[model samples]
Target: MRQDEVEIIEREICYQGFYRLERLRLRHRLFAGGMGPPIVREVIEKGDVAAVLLYDPLRDEVVMIEQFRIGARDDARGPWLLEIVAGLIEAGETPAQVARREALEEAGCTVLDLLPISSFYTSPAKTSQRTHLFLGRVDSANAGGIHGLADEGEDIRVVRLPAAEALLLAQQGKTDSAWPLLALFWFAGQREAVRARWSLAGEAPPASA
Candidate 1:
């Protein structure tokens, strides 16, 4: 269909200091058929952001960072939440690039065979941030290290733990971040199949290749 053939006009500013604002300015209907002007529900969604979920299949572990999350610092729980490697997509960086950069800077590991999981709004009701989730297998034996952007005023502590231990901690409600648990489930649910796939292809093969 052409532009004139569609309806529900939306206006948006796709860039700003730290975000892009989108708005559904007008709601209208299309000339579909004899169906009394086809209607459309107006929708305004954010463009994109990126998140990295690391899974170390070799060690059966996932590396997570503990940091003083200012957003949740004063939540009913506490500060210093556990989360997967995550960040917003910069002006010109791809999701894989963000994943690699975050993996090295936050967890101090070189990720291999990056896999994309999902792209979704972190919270649509409040913020217009679409986060792209990625899965990366890394060498967890030497993952924990002091790595973060001090110039950006970021202080992070990386830690590597067994998948079971991480899930247990989340189950006990120790960490306030939600992505860790989601990642845990994603990784755990696919653990056997991923491992089997990895083994069949050999360590030298690529998951996405």
Candidate 2:
């Protein structure tokens, strides 16, 4: 379908704070043919995100983070969820920049190099948020510590695990976040190739600030 196939009747901001909620009334072309009835939908405007799965090929380990997520507060697994380095793509920032910056701020590791993984809509049905995922090469020798901005109410704990063990967590459904699960599953298939490629490209420049 094309952009012309959809028509927006009206849009209004329902809420605006840490996150924005917008209510849209629109109609779109139907599969059978013709335009469908106008429908109202509320979408959370989370902006776009950039996330990276940090891997240290030399040590065969992955650096991850654990932090309290309000959305998962009621989850049986608990509110402190394991996740990859991620942050919003602020103005004038590319996805790669966000990935690298978040890595240092949230994981205490500088990304030596980056391999683009995938870009995806986080939840198209309910939100307009999208995510750009990457596999970042890092030296995990000094990758553990409590990180995150205190003013942001973030108390993040760095977690380093063997790449294989991290993949197992994904396969066994232990880590429930979408970002980590997707990255790990992809890594499971490309680990060897990535390790080889990154090893050869020793100490490439970090993402531009």
Candidate 3:
């Protein structure tokens, strides 16, 4: 429960590349009392991630992306998965900054405003990756086509679907990514309130040339 309750016996870097893998041997206080036996675990240091679900309340549509994912290569649905805009947090950038930048880079949609949604661990058992999620307001009128940094080997295709259709996709287990599913579910429950709030905040700015 507390940091002091755990004692680190040893930590070693098992692998290092684009991401680092560390093996840790530690002991912690048991719930029943007294210290437990030492445990060894390997964790992938993936850093933190920022993800945003781009929404156009005025048009009742959502902007999503389709990209090939190595992790899902063997799945029946294929490796190309539908996902929201997301990127890892670079050195000095904030989660919100990453969200806005990723929205434009991945979907070509400029985020006019943002509403924080959630912060969560993607998979605690394997990776130390946390994601900061948001609902970003955008004008989806001209949001489309392929985007992403070429050097990064990112070939992403922008997809736009009506809000209802997108939600149905999630309900049917089509939008398989955890981030988008979570964001879409949250948007479904808060859709009306968000629309009202954003409407009162004033019209969204026009898209840049």
The Cα error of candidate 1 at residue 159, in Å, is 1.0
lDDT of 3 by residue, 43-116 (tens): 99979999999988877788999999999999997999999999999999999999999998899999999999
Q: Which candidate, 1 or 3, would have the higher lDDT against the true structure?
A: 3
Residue range with the least summed lDDT across 10 consecutive positions in model 2:
200-209
- Give one clash count per candidate, in the order shown: 0, 0, 0
Per-residue alpha-carbon lDDT of model 1 for 1-209, expressed as tens digits?
Answer: 34454454555555454444544444334355532343333333445666777777756677889788777867876777888888767788998898898888887888887877777777776466677888787877777766789997788888888777877777787755666666666766777676655443445423420
Candidate 2, residue 194: Cα displacement in angstroms equals: 1.0
Candidate 2 per-residue C-alpha lDDT over 98-126 given as tens digits, one digit per residue, 9 for 90 to 100: 99999999999999999999999999999
Q: Which of the two candidates, 1 or 2, achieves a greater lDDT against the reference?
A: 2
Error of 1 at 74 (Å): 1.5
Judged by lDDT against the true structure, how good is candidate 3? 0.92
Q: lDDT for every model?
A: 0.70, 0.92, 0.92
Which pairs clash (backbone N, Cα, C closer than 3 Å) in model 2? none
What's the ranking of the predictions by lDDT, best on top? 3, 2, 1
State in Å the error of residue 121, model 1. 1.5
Inter-residue clash pairs, candidate 1: none
CA RMSD per model (angstroms): 5.9, 4.7, 3.7
List the candidates' TM-scores in order. 0.73, 0.94, 0.94
Give the runs in model 3 whose Cα sits over 4 Å from its true position: 200-209
Report the alpha-carbon TM-score of model 2 versus the true structure. 0.94
